[model samples]
Target chain A: MTFTETLQTKKFIVTAELFPPKGTNLKPLLEKAELLRGRIDGFNVTDNQRAVMRLGSLAICSILQKQGLEPIMQMTCRDRNRIALESDLLSAAALGIENILILSGDHPSQGDHKEAKVVYDLDPVQLLKTARTLETGVDLAGKKLDGSPKFCLGAVVNPMAEQLDLQLAMVEKKIEAGAQFFQTQPVFEKKLLELFLCKTKDLPVKFLIGVFLLKNSQIAMFMKEKLGINIPDEYIKRLATAASPLDEGIKIAAELISAMKPQVQGVHIMALGLEEHIPEILNKVK
Target chain B: MIITKQKELDKILEKLKNRKNIFIVGCAACATKCATGGEDQVQALSVEMSKHGLAILGSMVLDTPCDIRVVKKDLARDDKAQKAESLVLLTCGAGVQAISSVLEDKELVPALDTMFLGTIERLGNFHQFCSLCGDCIIDETGGICPVTRCAKSLVNGPCGGALKGKCEVNSENDCAWITIYDKLKKNKTGIKKYHNIKNNAAVNKPQKVKTR
Candidate 1:
């Protein structure tokens, strides 16, 4: 079933992030997608994830759809202006891509091209609203489209963000702007996720808790220190002291998913380059 | 106020390598306040340049190099400025262009990089507060401009990256949207509607205005 159809059903929705290759060699990327072909509901093809330059996500999504797989096209406001952003959405719809995940995106300074110019002409919320506007057969400026595109719009949230009140307000704003579902930043702590869920329980939307597979303690440390992700020391300690770090990482992911599965609608696993180990992690989920 | 930063001495010399004699010009206004183009800076740069073996014809700090009339009346007829092969301007881009407009024959080199339109928190501490986008929405945002202050220039609200009221992009800077949220909440104001997408036409390149 499509991701939108899955979200409407009572089944637990599952999605995983899939990044395009840096160069024209798509063997590795396609191979990774084929491994998890039927395991997940949708493959979130990232648009230059973290501002790093790569092949366009829309093309990959089209390729995935042609291969009989559901692709969630991740759109960011970091690289494209309003005109290009709107045009890309139309192109996605024409190509039969249904799911869209809107993001404000990481600033260009954070990526490979530090000196690149940022074109956040439309903020994430504004982009979500613009996508909804496109469904009405007109563009942001009320320009007519020969045919409108339909989409199941998704957005991102930071459940572990320190400023809870501000984050909740923005979540509400995203909902009002036409975000039907949200995928949060990686959450290692149960309390943080519970608090976020409790606070936003009234909001009419689905929450897919972000579960990043921690390969080792060093990566965990980097994420905690550099990326500002709230990874508890316990998980880091487990990864550090474990006999096999990768297995321990999978266990941690499985444990988090199992514990939080009842509360959240789904889990969005971010394998970060360890896509092959995703099935192992999911197998441990019970 | 306009914030300015001095270009590297090597770069300045590189641009002036072809010119014979060089003249240094500074601004006494924002450049002075920013310590990039003040009289003291101009004098220091002049001494520093001479050490690199470039012939210095003369140096002067104008009251405002951005004012075309001021540059024309003050520096245009100066003997040293007229004789110099190139003028190394310590003022902002406005100053370089202003002097270039009147001294059409001489090569004008900008010594300082115009950083941003900002406010001075204290000496040597500056914060950019405006993008000069030509569209103002501070009234709806509790006087805080998300357009200029937010790292992403998000107008609808804060991006999810803000942590502990600090921007994820720059940890030192407080997230602009959080600050705006606090102010509006303190005033007991309901969360305002989305400001919508910014009108980029208002921020068209090489913007100009006729006050009259």
Candidate 2:
């Protein structure tokens, strides 16, 4: 089934991102894919997540497709330009990869290789426009191609921006750029997400609120201090004070999903390396 | 093409004493292809000179330094002419003369040595090919010119001085004639047209300097 169709069927559509292993062995990741196959509507295959090179996202999505799972292939503008981006999209369409999540990837400095040069030929907004242009068989420069590609182009938004007006402006721009759906950054403070959702309710796009599972108090604090992700003090205290951190984190995540179910269209759970406990979290919400 | 190594810039700058106005010019056509006379390379050079306490007047890039029309237009827009006592041409010798021909009162210097036309395999990697001998022989050799392939520019067969498919003198590279022969033979073609022929040895002449 198409990703949109499946989302229409499920009231609170739950999705997750699975990064392929860096090593040649795919047995572990394949097993994880199988575990979440029926539980989640679809899974997202990240394109070089955190800038650490893994197997290509297209290949992983193809593998997931063979496993009777719908895969959302995440495409980033970090490594490729308009030409290469369009070529990969056409290949994805030919391979029956329907769902796509576009992102302006992290800088090369954040990755293992700090010396690698970055090619930001087109930003995330431009990439969304390029995807729409590909539907008409033309490139960004208006050059016609042999065939066009069909894609459910999705974009990312950081709703936790310091300025609410700036964030709302970007949302309007993404909607104008042909972004059919948006998967936002982790929303720890439900109030902040509520404000963002209210401001963007008039946008003609679907919203999937992001939920990141915290392994422990230390990791949650690290994300707060290092990544500037505003995980509330109350949530951190709840997880830190629990006897079983995983169970506490899952309980809190399930609570969040249940609360946000009425506010948004879907939930994008980024368990990070905690794929095994996703079923536990899903079981609570379902 | 304009061939330039980073080390060559140091050698030329060593001769200059005081930092006056210095204008760096780059060629857009052949020099850009070789990457030496490109705008990015010229900007890098300009920044380096600025860091070394040299007064960089300005920098510019022309489409083709050898073209008379381009030379005239570049000279007309030379606002940096008053800052520098001389101009540094980051192009082939031919291009240097072309720039000098248009600006007779200014001193022109060669920032790069004119090398034979070639293609870049990767970054910081270069390989020479065409000598531009004023003739074309790509029709007979299955589109691979033996003149550029052969170490000795032999139009016939192997030079008998090849070892392990490599030129005996230059162990770093393969014998071009052997590669050409193998390519032609694999395509089931004959080399009878490339029989013994005698012609004057091509002389390595530097591009002529013209003064208007």
Candidate 3:
């Protein structure tokens, strides 16, 4: 089934993020996707994740679709103007890439290309609305398209954000803008997920809470300090003291997913270059 | 006011490689307040140029060099200014262009890079408050322009990266959306409307207007 069909039928949907290779070599990327071919509901192709230059997500998503894999193309507003964004959307449609996850990407300064110019011509909310508009057989300029694309649109949220009201407001805006599902930033503590679900329980949308695999205490610290994720010290301590940190990280992710399974509709796992261990983490989820 | 930063002396010298005699121009308004193009700065630049073996013909600090009338009235007819092979302008781009328009024959070189339209926080510190996108939407954002202040220029709301009221891209800057949310909450204003895509036609570059 397609990702949208899976979202509709599957009780506990699972999706994993895939970062396109920095170079033209797609062997490693395809190998990783092959590893989790049927394990998850969908493969979300990241668009230059963290603003690091990489092969474009559109090409990778198309390749995945050719290989009979459901690819959710992640689009960011950071690198393209309105014209390019709309054109890419139409191109994605023509390529038969259905699902789209729109994001207001990280500023270029945060990426490896610190000197790159940021083009956030369309805000994330506006991008989401634009996708919906294209689905209705019309472009943003009100011109009719020969063929429109249908998509299972998704957006992002930060459940542990201190600015809860603004986040919720944007959540509402995203839903209004045609976001059917939301994949959130990683929330380490179960209470944070519960708090977010409690606030968004009434909203008619699916929540795929972000579950990042913390490989070690240093990685956890980086997420806290650099990424600003709210990872509790308990998990970091567990990883720091454990003899096998990778095993411990897998255990922590599984434990969190098990705990979150009852509340959220799904889990979006971000293994971060350690995709080989995803099945090991999933094996321990029950 | 427009903010500016002085270019390195070496860069100016490189631009003035062939010219032996040079004249300096300064502005008394924004550039003067910014200390990039003031009377003191012009004198300092004159001395600096002289140390490089180039002769300084003359210098002038105009009231506002961005004004073509001021450029024509204060600098157009001066014998020393007219005699210089190159005119080094320690002013904003507008000021440099104004002088260029009036003194059409002179080879003009800008000694300062015009940074942005900003507000003066102190004598030396300046912060950009407007991007001059032409289409303004701060009315819905409680007067805090997310377009100008947000790192990603997200008009709808803050991106997920903001933490503890600080922007994820730069911790030194407060998250513009959070500040706007606070101000709106204080004023009991409702941010129910979602801002659509900004029209770029109004801000099409090399913008000009004819006021009636």
Candidate 4:
């Protein structure tokens, strides 16, 4: 089924963000995509995430489409100016890649090459607006195109953010920018989802709760430091004290899915390089 | 104002490895306030160079090193400056560039790294002011700079990673967008004050001005 059909018809949808290989080789990534063939509604091909240079997301998305799997192309505002972004969007659409997730990517300062000049020519809001505009027959400048691309536009959200009201306001704005769906940051508590869901209750956008699978207490603490995500102390304590962190992580993820599955449309598992462990997670989620 | 700090004494000495004569130029303005370039700093630097047996042609703390007219006149009249082979500029990047503009023949080495244009909260306290992106979005962001302050430079607001009102990259700082959001709300305002998104494209870099 198409991703939209899965969203509409199924009781719940499952998706994953695919981390492509760092090198030029696509065989490893293509093999991984083949491994996740039926496991998700669609896999989001990440752009040069964490500001690290990688195989381009559009290239992988196009190849993934040819391989008969639905791909959600993750595009960030860090690397491209307006023309490159608009051109890439159109090209991705032409190659039959449908889903597009827009983000204001991590700055180069945090990445390997601190000297790399950032080109945030379009803010995330502007990016969303541009994508929406392109979907209609004109570019961001309103120039006529031979054929505009149709895309299922998506944006990211942080439900667990301290500024709840501001997040709510932007939820309204993203919807205004023509975001059909939102894939949120990893959430650990119910109150956050409850508050965000209640606040955005009136909006038409679909919310996919992000489930970040922790490797261990070390990884958990590291993620908190790097991403500024506040992982619940209990989860950390559980990972910290567990006999096997991997096993405990799977158990916790399954429990989290069980707890949160009823509250939202679906979940997006961010295994964070633990793609091999996903089947175990899915197995226990039942 | 642009902020900078003194380069290490060892690093400075290493740069003067082969130089027999050197003239030090310090700024009395920003560099003095930052303690990077000042009268005492120049004197102390000269003393340190003396221990290494390097002959100091002379040193002066000019009130405004970046002012072309003042600096050009000051350098022209200074006898000690003319004798020196290397000019060690203990000032901001602008000061070094200003001196270089006139003293093109003199080999000049900057003794400090230029940090950022900032606002002085108080003595020894500084906050980044502007990135000079050319397209100003401060009015929309409640007088805070999303370009300079936001870790991701996200104008829209905080990214998904901001935790507890702090930035993702630097937690000590309140997220610029959050600050903007609160400030706008307190002012009974919103993003309507900001220009359209296309305006950001104006920063297509190699950004310059021909004030001439």
Q: Candidate 2, TM-score vs. the true structure?
A: 0.59
- Backbone clash pairs in model 2 (N, Cα, C under 3 Å; residues 3+ apart or in different chains), count: 2
**Candidate 2, residue B182: how far the Cα is off, in Å:** 67
Q: Give the poorly placed runs of model 1, Cα more than 4 Å off.
A: B187-189
Provide the interface RMSD of candidate 4 in angstroms, 1 decimal place: 2.4
Q: Compare the candidates by DockQ and give the number of the best one.
A: 3
Residue B67 miss distance in model 1 (angstroms):
1.1
RMSD of each: 1.5, 21.5, 1.3, 2.7
**Which digits, one per residue and each the tens of the lDDT, describe model 4 over residues A59-173?**
8888888888888899999988999999999899889887899998988877887898878888788888888888789997889989988878888888987777777777767
TM-score of each prediction: 0.97, 0.59, 0.98, 0.91
Q: Per-residue alpha-carbon lDDT of model 1 for A169-285, expressed as tens digits?
A: 888889999999999889999888889999988888898989999999999999998778888999999999999998999999999999998998999999998888898889999
lDDT of 4 by residue, B99-168 (tens): 9988878889899889988789986898886887778867667788887888767777667567677777
Model 2 is docked with a DockQ of 0.02
Model 2, A55-173: lDDT tens per residue? Answer: 89999898888778999999887787667987888889888888889886665656776676665445566667778888988876678878788878787777775545534545666
Candidates sorted by DockQ, best first? 3, 1, 4, 2
Higher-ranked by DockQ: 3 or 4: 3
- Name the candidate, 1 or 4, with the larger DockQ value: 1
- Compared with the true structure, all predictions reach lDDT values of 0.90, 0.74, 0.90, 0.83
Model 2 C-alpha lDDT per residue in residues B1-212, reported as the tens digit of each score: 44554337676577444748888888888778777888988898888777778888888898888887888876546677645677877878778888777787776767787666665676557777665664566666666665666544545443333445665436677766556655666553353332322222344365355798
Candidate number with greatest TM-score: 3
Instruction: Look at candidate 1 and give me any clashing residue pairs.
Output: none
Candidate 2 ranges beyond 4 A from true positions: A7-10, B1-212
